[model samples]
Target: MLDALIQQSVCLTQHYTGSPVCNPSRAALLTGRYSHRTGSLDTLEWWGLERLALREEWLLPLGGLAVPGDLDHEAAKEDKEREARSDVHEPSRPSRFVSFAPLRDFVFQPAALDHYAATALFLACVRRLRPDFAPTADDARHIARICRLLEGMPLGIELAAPWAGKLPLGEIADELAAGLGLLATTLRDVPPRHRSMRAAFDRSWALLSVPERDILRQLSVFRGGFTREAAEAVAGATMADLSNLTDRSRLRVEPSGRYAVHELIRQYCGERLGAEHEAEAGETAEQVHDRHAAHYAGFLRVLEPQINWRASINSEVGPETGNLDAAWRWVIEQGRYELVQAMVMGLYHIAVAEGRYQTTLRLFDAAVQRLRAQRGRGEGGAGDAPTDLLLALLLFCQGHMCIDLGLLRRAEACTEESLAVLDGIAPGRLREEQTLYTKGLVALLRSWQGEFAEALRLRGELLSWLRTTEVSVWPHVPQVGTLFVQANECASLGFLTWHLGQYDVAQGWLRESLAIREQLGEERWRAYGLRTLAGVLRTIGELEDAERLTRKGLALSEAHQDRIGIGWSHSALAATLMSAGRPGEAQSHFVESLAVAQDSGHHALLILSLNGLGALALRRGNLDEAGQLYEESRASFERLGIAGTLRYAEAVIGLGEVALARGDWSRARARFREALAARACRAWEKMDAVAGMAQVFAGEGDTSQAAELLALVAHHPFTAHATRERVEALLAELEAELPAEVFAVATARGRARELDEAVECLAA
Candidate 1:
């Protein structure tokens, strides 16, 4: 069965030496004889080997024998004839024979002992023989070179051992570099093939068929290792071809099912290919690289969506990141801009989502530079809608990333350029569709920068366009990602209103968008909607509903690994918990939210989280802690160009409360005044500021002034039960401190003050 298996294998090279010496082992194997029967128990008695007794149990060797000059065929023939005459039946063996070379495996590294024993023993013999030599450190380095050249093969080490004794290890290493020609042993006992390393490799090379040789040479192009699919694409090799190479040990299939060639063998194969295609002048090598680049470029696209949708960022795509990088390098170097664009687009989403800011920034910058260069050369943008759209999309993505980082100026610049590119393209519904979404982004950025009036105007325009325009006119392709801009349009409007403190109205818009996203099966956007609506709910005294919505959003964010959504949901959840009087739970969520926001570089989200934490601290009467948190959050909002926004209004209120706790009544009034001055603040937020100033007035024993501010707060809906209770306590206190006629007059005077006059009252 073993003989049959050997016959079926494509190629097999056997060097079985049952007697430990070449001549004796050859005599035994060729004549099917045991060492005792052959009278070759030792190497010294192997001369003129003939007449060996056959072992009945021994199987025939069925592969070709290529003994290059060591064990001569003439000697084997004499042994066969002697065996026939000695009444020993000739063992059945394959008749095919060829001249070939065998490349030896390297086992020189210290770790190699785990896999190879013969090479280890050879090294042991060398060390023992040279005990008195006492080579220098540099000489030890040269010894490593010598080992590499001989690939630590048992025969090669044995042959090179004599030179190591006669010359310095460095000189022996240099001589080997001139190939086996100069390293040949002059001893008459050693065969010519066994004298040098090259002879063995040459003998192995001679046995390969043309197709097998071609496959081996092509496989040298791969770096690291390659999958079978990659091998088939880049090397133009089939499974059967790889299997044959693997069986012959020309290619090694790793346990992971990847194929790899030994480094030395790869170098040898590269040289072989270079020699064969000298006339082609490296053209074939270039083609292989191109195929490799193309193959991995496609691979990036397949894994792109999963990057933001799952936590497989480190598992599935992480390992292939090197290959994708290689592909990008080649594409960029070769000026394959279209491929570069595709690769960049595929990787950018995951890169940004994974918080690989530096990588994504570099890739985006490179892509834009390349695209501009191509356009300069008149190689692109000549009615290339797809490429133009892709370019615009990349700019838009960069703008969004900038927004996350709170770089509103840069965000505006990117979105403006994206919009310009879209406008520069041919006029069409698709262009208009993209223009509306890009406009919404610009508006959102404006809103982030505290330009509420301008932002609301621009967003309102986009909302109008989306409402009047039919969804059928928009591009139906999956590349649109969100498909309908209406959902996002509504969500953006909701967010803007949320900043304006119209919590009740914001909740409706966000809910509408959430329902639309659910119908569209856009889970990522749905998470956004849930988080936004939760913030609105939290502000409007709906703690339980806020917690539920925020938890749902947090679950979705975690499931999708959307760090931005996760951060937002965490802050919103923290706000709900803080309002529910769960300070400890709220503190942890606030910390987690801040950490996530900071790591993700979402400055806008960070502002909200910090403010939430500050509010919680204020509620717990940790005046110093709340003051620090609120001031830091205020600085962030201003740094992001979003000062005076409703978010900032809340932070101002916390700072006022901090002042009130410190008995700095005048400073408390000033902070409250700052929030009341922002006319865009929601009625409830303005009421909170007014109520705070009332507390300051009451602290100063001015019951009449306190009654006026308290009356203004009484007219609006109370968002926080704690704030409402505080206001009621102050109102009752004012009523008890003053005469009924005085309290009634002050309350009526506060009620008579116009909303703007009331806000200006604090401002004045």
Candidate 2:
């Protein structure tokens, strides 16, 4: 009878509402096959209807629904068959399938309304419900939050839109935190299940098989999303179960191959999981939580070795950050110290690499305090290698993160405590290696605090000791007898030598360090080496190579999202650009570096960017802005307790240049003298200072003295290219204003003076 009716009719249309099993039956009738075979196993129209195997002869267009690509191909094949049966071949019409879904768009796109078409649907519903409503800025913000909280479900937005007339937008948003109870409608024309979100969820829940329901409940343990492996391990879910849930619109599979439950659905399922239920597997919420924690803990432990060696493994960890965070919190709450120890180092490295400084710091700080409290209770004594080693490692990781964040005092305290903890361990290879690494970190702290000479001495001693020692440390790579600790010391010495203006020595050490790091295949540390080497190249007037190396380092850093590397690379690139006489480009990079440094709380990088910007401002004749920037850089350096460093001296020279630009001869001279007096001042910085003094002398009408000092700076091989260019230009101007014979005599005298003699003469 149904076939006779379909054969007799011109066209047939079927519509159903609020029936849990309607779509599957409709799909079965259309395809003449089992609904499961057609992949149509549920009644949710948006996700399930697309699974139907509708024939090509049917001209009905399903708006806002995307037919799968294979279905389109099937339709084309049927069209060719129909054409072959006819007398004349006809051109195939375009596929009538559209890929737009108003509700699904809201579900899949980012939470921002302006970026998604959901904003239109939301506004249309709002205007229909409350015609006089004009949203203020605050109302718009609340509306966006509402859209996000609802996951852009059309019914939820429609049900909540009517409340716009009865309550403030903020109140409506706040009420949503209470859950699905807040979104219900009284419209009599609507189906009962559609009248409230909970009713709809309940109807869907009743249709799920017991296994499906159990997996759904267990999946609530995840925060963001989970991969198939993660789902299997944590929730005991199979592929078929996940597919069925997805067909029912209970979960969303992202393009990254991760499955996500909607927040509202997750909350509902979480509540169900928490309640009493006789699940066949007999797993409770606590048991599921335990499994979730254990799975991620093991996951992190597997990645710990790679993380310890600073490999480019952040891509593997980034997607699972939410799950790892949830697992960490659970383990800490349950006082699962072994689990905590298993995952802590990996988490710390991942957090630092991703620039989640404050959150990781807070988490680790709490963990440390808890461990200390446990030790105080005599739960773990000094001879307990595992517990003591974990604590010491935690303190060291904390100290390293503190260095990045510019919390110097805290970093010092943590490093010292880490050493103390290691002292309690029995003498062994692990203890010895750990002690050497901790001491290396202490050298780094000292370097940052402007104690470069001491840092150099300490780092050199470590390198010497590692070279003589025959202990086999577990290398990051396959190479036997390669000491990464020795390579690290070499890099430290390179940095210290650079700070002390030993460019030739710095380059040699940095090259050696880079060679070892390249052999290890550590991309993060290799990028560091590249940027540090680029700094030396830029200082020695190799602007092109400097720019090339810096850009390469920047790309590597961006690939891993390493904030410190990104910040430093930008600053280095900007300085190189500035030296190449590209102030405009340099300013943009400096600004970018400053913003990243500020966001990452990298005080040293921030100061470097500020000083670079100051140099650019001075070059552009913006004296007041230059002065302000220099003063800010100086103040920040002082605050970091490294006021005597070469960077601080650079800032002082910048101030003197600003003063010289303003023709404030006395002030410029005083600032230059102050910079020259810095113990950490490099030869190039001293040259810059003396050049400023020449300008001051020229401004004070001492042309002969100015000519001599300018010639001294110009002839100094240690003078930077940009500084030499500026000094030469000044010399030309001065020679034009002086007697020819007198200018020649003064320049000859200046060229004969040694660098130290020239600096002493300028200072006098």
Candidate 3:
């Protein structure tokens, strides 16, 4: 699994700086500095270890292993003999013995016990707000990470944590107590670490009064982060009880106008209820999760809009620009994302209806776990159409999540298994169509990510398949996902074309897709659609309009707190700023964009931000800084096995500019030529390379060739841009190579801008 996580991961050289010892090394490691700097000193203690007989039960034995150094000691002989027996049983069988590494049933983070303590405190507040129960420290962290994704929930983790101060968290999580069957536990299962909150939650729950437990029961009705009104309605008690809860910090109200209960408490309440009234509790939990899921699905719907805010801005007396910040706030800071995280444990209908395809997958994983638990009691939640549908839906959703997470091979396997299951069933119109729709959507996503080039062909084939299906299949088919897929394709292809400098062509596709999104009437989505349009507008130099459109998109992204989407808008704004010669401001925006990529670990945007940073540095006359930024971007590109073409070539051009600044003509020419050979693909940014190449030729006394390259720049529709100072400088160098008479003629012929304009030109 660690290797799987590392698949799409790109490694970069990082310098190490910390202590090299054991115990004192922890201090240096924690501070990311040496013990000398951190004031930490060495301390050593012997840890006793001796293997004992009769301690091999799953949990006990895992914690009991105490082996001497490895050179195939006595204990290893039993395993070799077993392999020898297996080989004898099947003469052709290859030996499957691994001499060193032990196969384990569970993986634990030995270095992170302190981290677990910190995480528990953070999750306690969340546990207090939730209705069902408080989870273990481990579950609390998972919940917190998900909750933080919602815009209104940045402080969410602190709201839902559990007590870890009284007992071992593993005891509470009996289901996970197997520890690792083959790996030795570094610490005793019972220890001084047991005094933390993970143990305290169990004690606290046991201490709750019947009245408090009853109040908790009523609280379970509400799912996710709730409103103050919700607590008042569900708590089934007087105003004094509500006040008491608030006074005790058991309930918290956020500035975004939502109320929350701690998740650890919710987990505690939920676990007890299962033993007390199993069937009823399960149904209630399902209901709460379903509603929670439904609310956030609303957030997803708004992802495709292109808002018209000019009316509101114009209606105001002040200039429209001042309202931009306010508008940004109104659009982005909404409470939509909280429900999305709750959806991870939500009911099936909400997931399907909301088109939260990605989250649905995550929720399905939780459901599978729950189902297994239910199975332990000789019961099954699997049943009729809706229940079965949800199950199948979850399988497909999980498959898609794997795909988006960049496990393409695993994604394919999961989706295929899903398709096989669906095929075994009797056809229902909506279900049949949905299966196909999701399949098609994944195919297109693969295409959009530069993984598959035959996307158009595959999409066309899916469309053809849809047409072949009967209208009767409409009831089962998924329409929303399919519609979005069309919109997505148009948007993705539109950007590609814009990059290729075909603005008009790009606009055709973007406008059509944008119009569809506007008609969809989902505010967030319309905003997303307008983003695509803004990109097209910017390419054609409609800076003011592009700014407006992009802000609208950013608002939608913020309203939903969609990290992936928000980062994209940041990049969009930064690019426009770059073109407008606001590199200093652009640099800040690019940095913000890079932060978004860092948050999601999305490779595409991370590299894009680096490139943007490099360009901004060049604009600011910081050549060394530009080179570093370019080098950083190159490292990302190289790790991903992609920069050898576009990004690498662009970085080479940036290097050439740096060399030119130092009067290194030979190096500059070599860099420029090297850049051109690699710049085989179309990209508007390639203009920088062409312009630099012209400068190189002129520097080498190749007047005719330099003049031709300069002419290409001079005639470029975008070349007259106020930010083309670098190209103008290249043209000036060409002029120096020509005779005075021909230069005059060329100047008259508009081969050069008016000298004043040329002198005033700025780099784009």
Candidate 4:
């Protein structure tokens, strides 16, 4: 019939299935709005047919219904309960008058419903039909689950709404998972087509040709959706087959031009694929599986660079993550170590960078489990250089993700294991370049763990190796030269040295790295180098230059949509602004940074921004606000198991500053000591904590100890900044209180003492 219409010069337009069942779909078609709006949400009841039930053949344009919001909030709970019961109490209300709630009523939008408007519509209609329903919090959640299980089909909602009265929402949802057999209706007046969800799908399925059926079955392997290119590769589906399936309402074309099938239809196709095909029992299945896996693997590998470096990485690659997972599972089953390694490496770091930490960890765990299993089976045993290399690289990637998640102990374990594996390989047998890469990662881990001297030593060694390593090809980033690796090493070395108070040397190394990245056209890494150098400049009191570099880095990251880059650059720029005494502007950038951090779930970036906000709050004398911010940051760091890091120390010390302001001498001293004891405490943070402790001593009438501690930090650059005015005033007051000779002696001894010696004195 569709072919006949096309032959007769008919134009077929795209539309939603309206509702999953016939009666509701017809009512929507007749009313030009949603089933709920027309008071025809049930499959068996003929909606709008009290006026007309003609079967004339004229052109019918079925406009799609807008989806409803996911009602999971407290207000939404009240509104949904009220709305659900409205139909039972107010049957005389207009079709649209049953207290329908808008999206704003929900506590928050569920992430899954962000795209599926049709699903939201079905959920609204289902909620409306159950006017007498009351539910617990868990039952309220089942609304989303039911919509998802039914794939937002109207017929499924119609069938499930009745069950809401006798059984719990969860039970109805669970029954739907058992298949369409549970969704049958007993209404005698309804058309046979609308009697069951399966009946509607069966009519369409029977109209398909053998090729169409095969393509549809194969396409069911895709989880979310698939592009034309993916379809052709994985399912051996041609454009014509897709068009036919689409025309027959067996498949859907999303606004992004990707194709999708309803979950119910996909399940049906899956069953057919399992039952009807001989390939499932033989070698042909392997070929099809290989093609499907290879298609997604290649897709990820091609986009790996963008995924790793861009802020828009999630939007670009998120749609295909389901397909990627499917590919990984297939390769794992086949014990294909090489493919598994490629798949994990391609997405793991990018996933972490985008804040999908749990997902990336799962990927790492699954791949590692497979690798260990292969080793136990002797497939990955000794002298298999390829498998060994794959395992080592996989472990390295896993460690990198662990670092981002603040799993410092887990990170070290994985990275050390990677190093151990690399060391076991004969020196000349393994690739020299990959070995250097692992060593570089270990250096980074050391830096994050606050072993500054060791970090600098390892990073310097990496720089030396990077200078001599030759590369004919730079994977993924072809335009980046061998100096790219050296440039990155130099940046790390500069940051490490800067933290250790070697400013001049840090400047030289940072400048050289930035110059190299710019010359090589390494845009993303160039942004990183700029932000790193900007931080160094900020530390050295070169505020103008620091602001300029940070601004450039921000612009570059904004252009590339690199969230990590944007976040880091924003932090650098904010700190620079704060140092320049522009607290208002700095607060704005910190707010932006916090928003981005929360959105991306980037723990490290979030901590930095929160600390910055706390610092700003302290300066403004909003002691309570500063305390709250610092406490939140400390809690997050502790939760992520990264409380020993320098960032967490800053938060701890900020809390001490608040305590000092509130005149809580004992509490201030304790908090300052806690900050000082953190292994990750860097020089500036240590100085800040010491200053806060000195203030506590002054408050306690221990002027001698207070003057000595104040003298230790008096010559530091922090004392010159506006942020330290309070500490500086306290020092002046203490200086006057002490005898001239005592003041001079204390200052002289402090100036002569090394940082470690001062720490020891404070501890005493």
| RMSD of each predicted structure | 17.6, 11.8, 18.7, 8.8
Better of 1 and 2 by lDDT: 2
Off by over 4 Å in 4: 1-31, 34-142, 145-151, 160-196, 279-286, 303-316, 427-431, 471-481, 580-588, 595-601, 619-622, 640-642, 717-746
Candidate 1 Cα misplacement greater than 4 A, ranges: 1-289, 300-333, 340-345, 373-388, 467-475, 478-483, 638-642, 676-684, 717-722
**Arranged by lDDT, best first:** 2, 4, 1, 3
Q: In what order do the candidates fall by TM-score, top score first?
A: 4, 2, 1, 3
lDDT of 4 by residue, 42-81 (tens): 2221111011223443322222222333333333222222
C-alpha lDDT values of all predictions: 0.62, 0.71, 0.45, 0.65
Task: Report the number of clashing residue pairs per model.
Answer: 7, 0, 65, 9
- Which of candidates 1 and 3 is the stronger one according to TM-score? 1
Q: For every model shown, what is its TM-score relative to the native structure?
A: 0.62, 0.75, 0.53, 0.80
Candidate 2, residue 301: Cα displacement in angstroms equals 2.8
Cα misplacement distance, residue 698 of candidate 4 (Å): 2.1
Which candidate comes out best when scored by lDDT? 2
Backbone clashes in model 2, listed as residue pairs:
none
Candidate 1 C-alpha error for residue 546, in Å: 1.5
- Clashing residue pairs for model 1: 100-203, 100-204, 101-200, 101-202, 101-203, 101-204, 102-200
Q: Candidate 1, residues 1-764: lDDT per residue as tens digits?
A: 32542232211112232112233211112211224546532221110011112333332222211211114443233222222121112221111111111101122234333232223333444565676654454554355445444433444445665566777766765665433444445656555554454554566777788778777777766544578998898777999999888766677665557775643355567667667743433446667668888888877766555443444443445334445655676776787766775676566665554454544665676667776666667776544676677677767778877777767678788898888778778987667766766787888777755677788789778777666765443324454444346787788888877766567778788888888767766676688888888777766667788899889988877766655566677777887888888989998888777765665566767777788888777777788888999999888877767677546787888898899989999899899988877544655677788888888888998879989878767755533455666777878978988999999999888777766677776778
lDDT per residue (tens digit) for residues 231-267 in model 3: 4544445656655554444454544455445443444
lDDT of 2 by residue, 655-677 (tens): 99898888888889988988887
